[model samples]
Target: MRVVHRLFEMLIPRRPVSHQAKDRDNLQDWKNYVYGRARSAWARGLPLYGSSFRFTIVYLCGDSPADIDNIIKPIQDALVGVVFSDDSLVSDVDSHRRFISDGIDLTNLPALLIEGALSGEECVYVAVDSAGPLGSYL
Candidate 1:
């Protein structure tokens, strides 16, 4: 898949919230936190990306072993009306969880993730790219 342009990219300096958060209060807090961070980074109420997009989420952590799959939806839903208009617009997605302390193979990882691990912060690296093929035809 071709990435036309990066619509949004940020190394969120916090652990990603997993969809498995069954506690209502905790889930609400996570949603609020995501909204606050995303809203602040992006304009509060700007036009959302409407075309096909790709999401690449990397969870860099030392211990919290949440399923990578479970974490994706919450983050994606949290970005609704902020990053992209709808989930249906997502053409591709890549999600991964990597441990920092363990000798992670640095070859494939991006530089920022290495830096984050070195900094000792369990954070989420999220990037959204515009998928060119379908969008280009329009």
Candidate 2:
């Protein structure tokens, strides 16, 4: 079974927030906000399926510098119960960082391609694919 799930511009943290003395409050706030958004998005989307799957996270940036690693953690954590039963079901994971510049036609960009682009505004895409136990290797 193959399943693809997506959460639009729901906030994703670049990294797990550190609970250092100075940044505790801010970090907690960030964690709360991101986690809440992810949960809400997952709750509203299609139900999860598949015991093992490949997950892809595409980050759309708007003229800002961000670490891909930092952005994926909150998402992975938040999806634990909502998307899959647990994060371990995500056997293979990949991430893509994209920069959308002004005046660049979005229609022709290969990386920006999505399954249903014509229906709504562009946002982050999370795709999960389960290749049926060994996929093509068997």
Candidate 3:
């Protein structure tokens, strides 16, 4: 199986309100950034994966906490055409969020931590691949 990974080295924008007259600008901005990143990554010519794919996302954030569902929806939508041709092809999604220190620690861990005890700049890592019979579900 081949897994394609892309990291957007910044905090993912939250899904904006959907009232067309109210938050249109915010909604558009969020979509622009997310889609732009996915489009750029897609340009790398990764293989067009088959169905039964897995999607994994790791979000490293600072002190402020955000709703997991809100954070993941944009990413899932952004990757539709770029990663899997369509979202229906995805069969599994595993996602996580951590305040840097809550993740793997190394002797050099302190160097990566900041005043917030995590990198001030949030990071979103997305990995996708075509695979089957994964984990306990299989």
Best by lDDT: 1
What is candidate 1's local distance difference test score? 0.74
Of the candidates shown, which would achieve the greatest TM-score relative to the real structure?
1
Query: Model 1 over residues 1-138: C-alpha lDDT tens digits?
Result: 432455676667777667888786887788778766777767436636557887888888778577889888888887887888887888888887888777567665556666666677788877777765655545
What range of 10 consecutive residues in model 3 has the weakest lDDT sum? 108-117
Per-residue CA lDDT of model 3 for 85-132, tens digit only, reads 677777787776767646544333222122223434566666665545
Compared with the true structure, the alpha-carbon lDDT of candidate 3 equals 0.56
Ranking by lDDT: 1, 3, 2
lDDT of each: 0.74, 0.53, 0.56
Best-to-worst order by TM-score is: 1, 3, 2
Off by over 4 Å in 2: 1-28, 43-50, 102-123, 131-138
In candidate 2, position 15 carries an lDDT of: 28
Tell me how far the alpha carbon of residue 76 in candidate 2 is from the true structure, in angstroms, after superposition: 0.5
| Candidate 3 C-alpha RMSD relative to the actual structure | 6.0
**Model 1: residues >4 Å from true position, as ranges?**
1-4, 43-45, 103-115, 132-138
For residues 1-138, could you state the per-residue lDDT of candidate 2 as single tens digits?
A: 423334332434332343332565766675576557666656446545556766677665555535666656555665666666677777777777665443234564333344323223334555555634555534
